[model samples]
Target: MGLEFNDETFRGDYTFRNSAKAIARFPFPFAEDSYMYSVNMEPHLPGRPGSVFEHMFDVDEHYVAEMRDRAQVLAEDPLRCQSLPHMTLAGWDLLELIMESKARDYPQWFSLTKDGNRWHWINRPLQIEQSFTFLDETTLPYGPMEYITRQTQGDFTLQDQRDDNLWIEAGMVTTQADWSLDFDIGMSFHEWHAPVPLAHEMRVFDRALKFLLNLQLGAPVRRFNWTMTVDPLLDTSPENYPKWGPSKTTMTPETIGHRQHLRVELQTLHRLPRSNAIVFPIRCYLIKFEELVTVPKWARRLHRVVRDIPDELATYKGFIRNKPLMLDYLSKYDDGAPTSPGIWPE
Candidate 1:
């Protein structure tokens, strides 16, 4: 049997303490590698996507015999070719002050901060949790390859190491007889809005509201969360595994892609008086869970967010020549595919 679970829940947590100067990191869930791309869009020289892990895999030879020195990485494809302006990530977003911090320019470029006029960022926190049951391991790995789970479902609470933020991720197997739950909680503190993309300071809540609500897809289907509340000890001191600092990981670019859908709901408060206010809409996926990673290599053009699809998305005139998002890119005429059902080939 593959990885099978009857239930699933995904949550996306985000905090924008600083909009500019902050950074964004994209990491693979299981792979201990990442393509640390910058959010500033300040024009990086160009960096190889899969280099660090490659070097790490050969650490024994490089560390002593060959040895990886600073000069070695600097001369590489990604590091040398890409000219990225230095930007520090994971620092300075104060704490829960997400909206207030976003209200102004953050990480205020080196030039501005050097002038001695410092801007304020709350040092926000973000967390994303993915838990579900898998039935088979055809194309995907049978078990988690790298980001192994030690324990889950009990007292689940993680702290914001870099700052005051705290996050907890957990899961459990509730059964009809011996129902034991599994909890996987990861906690860390980092700065948001430190990057420039969101720093565009796109100040229009309505659009964000639409995306969160999935407003265009029709009415929403609310879910009733069934979770256990447990209090886990605040672990600040680090010994080794799961603790912050230099970690030996297998995360790579290939691991992070093709993730499942997500959902989130947050209640926020504003300045002066910590008063009750609007509840930010949660991001939910209309696509079923099983369909998330099942993509067709033949069809690349239609693999985009549904919102970006133009009127052409409604009709499918060909099959093998031009594939559909699913079997039915156009949503009409069944392409008469025995192997695939919802295809679009008139």
Candidate 2:
């Protein structure tokens, strides 16, 4: 659960997964289909650290791509940026609140200021500074929010310290805008090689709060996440979904491109338990919004008698191969629960 990955990382190493019980609750705890996300770990260059970035669902690929292009463009010409276009992205309100408190409670370590909703950081006398803005939930399809993360060390030599060129895995998420009990959860290991992740990875309070933040909103956004540790209990199995929707999905590298997209979702839980400094930009898309139908009132009470609970395998705490915990949990709630015949997806 505490391992790390670089550019040469494996697919099975850093993707989202859950325990047997977790998958059994698909469309509830996990999405039934594979979420299309472009996992960009930054440019794999020498003396440069790669980062993991995701863009799920079709938000606006053109805009997301442009913001990243411009940020890198402006980095070279801070002065000339005035003549060109520069966008001030949103989503920094939470950071300003913490930075302000830090300035008062821990003045020496943290210094924060807010110009309107814009927040900046200066830990030293060097040109080392950071800034971020708050972005509201979007209902319209527009370009991605833009921001930059840089690590500059002038004559500084600290292996562990983040002292290098600025790097950003820029991206965005789309609005789901559906009327289903659907949600998205993503969890990843925050790369240990980066220092930015220390803010959340090393702090239990921050990680726990992040969990609540994504829940408040319908789906989980990766920008608020870090690198996730590969937990053995985590669900990372083959994709399975009911094919009753008008829009189906074709998942492939060429089709999904840098991003992996999936449709026909009921509910989702995209989580991030990152141990490194990374950002995952996730978006939920509901191709079709239908009636929030439920069966007879008493139908919801048929779970206990219909579903069977398997005996404890090795340790109830964890799971063994092919253990049917998912089935157990599903059965536990089938008192009169609705059942979808296996052939329905056809």
Candidate 3:
């Protein structure tokens, strides 16, 4: 069957919701009861059919709406999509990677025809068709990275590997978890990650950087990074904190279940074949506490994880203020049962 896209908004009345299929496949990040900082990297291999990992880039029900939200974000702030002049080639490399992957993985929704440098691309869901010369910027409405990523449902950053380090040079970041692409655009790996607590002292970044610097082509890695958001706000960026931050104060026990959301980012890193730069795509997936509790295992495990998580970690995740309320809501579903190992619902 073809995918059924959802027509919902991420902000302004917050009409977002998850169908049963979406809830079943939500990437709940907690592997065990509690969460911590670790280099929990794994090979980005395909998984069970119908799951998000089944494809190179998972396009879900929210694809169309998310693209609209991205366009709105870009219109409001063009800085959200940027590439250093030297990074244009890397952008083209990223564009080719996404186009080929989507066309191969989802032929019904997307198709690409290539005759040497000339290429014709069609995205059925978005109703966009364009024929442009490969590596030629003038033919496209936007830059290569922006053009592809606008249709893509994730925040992408292109890292240039140099001087035994990965430099954050180019990206299209809109649905971020309290990070600023504009501020961290020119920073090195550690420099941008310096703000993250415990991970730096734990040498997580050091080991991760070393691992990525030697990342082989065709072999990408993925990991999960999660946080808590007051609502289904995709653009939880520092640049617009004032707009969404105040909502955190309005969550009461009566509304906690519907208002609070578990924001999980399925982050994948790939080495671009031509530019030799790593394109990191951080796909944000949000599930409300009420919808997530539908699965007994997830509910029990999430309750324990939130209840037992360290205060510093909770504070850093921007949910410390609502931790008590979350525990109050999630605790009702936790029956002190032991959850099985791994993130899957058993």
Candidate 4:
């Protein structure tokens, strides 16, 4: 059977939610009871049948709703999606990659037919159908990267590699975690990541840059990045901080379970075949504290990770103000029972 897309909102009335299946497949970021900065990358290999890692791009029930949210974000601010003139070819490369991957993996919902660059694409879930000449920008309404990423979940940044560094030349970043694409548009790998705490001191980005500089085609890599969001607001960019920042001060122990959300980003990097650029897709997933605690193991480990996390890291994640409150709610689930090692619930 085909997946049933959720009809929900990520902002304002905040109707976003996780079904039993979503919670079960949630990519709980921590594999241990602690967290720190590290280059914890792994081969983008397929995993257990029902897990999120099972596909190149995992499409969940939130697909259509997330697209709706992306459109809303872009409508409000077109700067959320931008591409340098030179990066247009990279955008086409990205479009081809996502279309092919989704069409192959979720054939029921997406399909692509190609006849020597004359392509027909259909996205049943979003009710989108387009026949555009591949690499021909005039055939599509938007740039290539913006076109496909609009239909696909996640925020994508196309990096141009030169002088042994990756340049963030183009991207569609509406669902970022407190970062602004407009500000970081032309920065290098290190420059854009400089604001992240301790990672540079630990030489995490140094080593990561070295590894990605040598990334091979058809051999993508992925890693998990996580942070805390007070609500299920996806457009948590710095531009809109004033609107969502005040949310942190409103959380109480009584409401934290429902209002607090664990935001996990399943970030994958692929070497585009044509432009020789790296396409970094940051796919964000959110599960409320009440829903997360449904899994006893995740509950116990999360409590320890948050409680014992370094104050600096907590502050950087924007949850230090409510750490005590989160601990109070998560503590009830820890129970001091030893959680089995590894991310899976035993």
Candidate 5:
């Protein structure tokens, strides 16, 4: 049986504080009249003037709550976080990079100190303070990747550039949007994204690998990808399909807006200073459909994109089942009247 869609009040408790600000700062996936997958990479300018490039790692109001979610997910399924043997040093590289970045950005809440090979990290928000050797896993409760992921809000993956390509060397990914880190482990760049439509036909993945390999130490690249979900869930991995799969069939015209949500992944890829591993961090944000139309611009743009989106992309995103209903709900705001049946795709 599918999950029942009740007439429930949508609460965006998991999102960052201030919806207007969140929407304003939101990395809307579509840029122009159409949407397609591509190797969209931008420089890692932390303090850039634009809304998107302002930060590489975001530490926001939901920091505590999000970290708690990650802990719970890891507790239930340890496979949610995995690091291959060779990537151990890369894990340490990521931990130090994240610690330094967070401490520098939020000096009041986060601090890091180094004494020779030993280092201490202080996370005021979580009341956590620990000291560990740079590449020593014994000093921490778990492996370097898992230990670092436990403290941060992003799902991280460390990809090593070798054999003239990038390989999934190690990663600690707890809040996977739809993909599986365990399944993707050891898969090459092209093999990992094999499911994506048009990526290979257009050579997007190969081109992206070349671009990533050439990235300098200080330069990082970022992109946005989006889909719709029925609830605010961080562990929407395929293993938990029984929990969220029923959501699509249960949705109705009345419950669509309140029950359905727009989930977007704000992803950043950077070159690790020491190990030369490419660290990819992904942060997901969820906004209710009912709340989305409140921002007239977002609602209008989303409607246009959904309506114009190709069937292949729509099917891949799981939008085929409920696209018509979502479109009708958005159409109510586009015009005073609901969308006509004729306007909907077959």
Candidate 6:
């Protein structure tokens, strides 16, 4: 059987529907009640014919909206996009990968052409057509990675393998789900993941890095990670703590369903062809718990996982302050009472 897990970006343009189909297809992360970190990587391939989801990558309905949001974020804080001097080649490689993917998958909106080392790109969505030489810094206004990130939903992280390990050498991350790319840059594979409780004890990261190192060009790997957020807005980095900080103490039993959301990150890791750097892309999705309980199975599983979650893991996830309220809210779903509006009747 394929992998299953429990798992938005906000652009008011996108509305999450609480339909049976959406609930049935939802990536529910917990295999058991409690949560713990693991490598959880799976082969990156295209989805089955006619399937709603894609295998390695997905250009969702929110693609354009999220890209607009990213452009705004970068415009407001340029530091959100960074790259070291040595990662120039890797940046170019990633730009090509992204541009090629966009042109291939979205022919109507994007197209790419090449004449020897010179290339031309037409982006209908952004309303631009430009020609430039590959690897020429002056061709693109910003670095390749930074320019490409403005057009893709996921924030990209490029890690270079050296001394038998992968070091985070560069990335363009404007809509950080929660973690900071600034702090994670230059950290070794193990060092960056040190804060994750179980992955280290279980040797998950060690095994994962080994798998990543051995990964070939055509084969990519994907995984899922999830958490809860108080709002639908995407910018939750430490810099915006003041805006979302009060939600922890302010959420009550009645408002929990509407105010809280289940935030899921679909992380895809690709081994770049030329530079051999690992290209990590994180796509964030959000669905309100109020919308989640439309499916009985999701509601029950989520309740059990939250109830059984250990204090340390919960605390690490910033659930310490609001766990009780969330649990109480979920318990009502388990008890078969529709606490929120627009309940799908059994």
For candidate 2, write residues 34-125 as lDDT tens digits: 11122212221112111111112211212222233334433543321110011122112222223343456435444667677565665432
What is candidate 4's lDDT per residue for 1-346, written digit by digit as tens? 5578899999989999999999999999999999988899999987888999999999999999999999999999999999999999999999888898999998998999989989999999889899999989999998899999999899999999999999999999999899988999899999999889878888999899999999999999999999999889999999999999999998887899999999999999999998999999999999999999999999999999999999999999999999989998999998998888899988
lDDT of 6 by residue, 248-342 (tens): 78878787887788877778888888898989998776677888877675687678778888887777777778888888888887864332322
Query: TM-score for every candidate vs. truth?
Result: 0.19, 0.20, 0.99, 0.99, 0.88, 0.86
Relative to the unseen true structure, what is the C-alpha lDDT of residue 201 in candidate 5, on a scale of 0 to 100? 89
lDDT of 1 by residue, 1-346 (tens): 1111222121121111111111011111111111111221111112233321111010111111111111232233221111111100110111122223222322221011111322322211112123322212232221221111111111111112212232222211111011111211232112221221231244433333333332221122221111101010111112211431221132223322222111111111111112111111111112221232233311221233222323332221111122232323322222323222221211
Backbone N/Cα/C clashes per model: 49, 51, 0, 0, 1, 7
lDDT of 3 by residue, 217-260 (tens): 99999999999998899999999999999999999998988989
What is the lDDT for 291 in model 1? 30
Question: What are the runs in model 1 whose C-alpha is more than 4 Å off?
Answer: 1-249, 252-276, 281-346
lDDT of 3: 0.94
Q: Candidate 2, TM-score vs. the true structure?
A: 0.20
Candidate 1: residue 221 lDDT (0-100): 23
Model 5 deviation from the true structure expressed as Cα RMSD, one decimal place: 6.9
Those runs of model 3 whose alpha carbons end farther than 4 Å from true positions after fitting are none
**Candidate 6 lDDT (Cα, 0 to 1):** 0.74
- Show where candidate 4 strays beyond 4 Å: none
Task: For model 3, give the 10-residue run with minimal summed lDDT.
Answer: 1-10
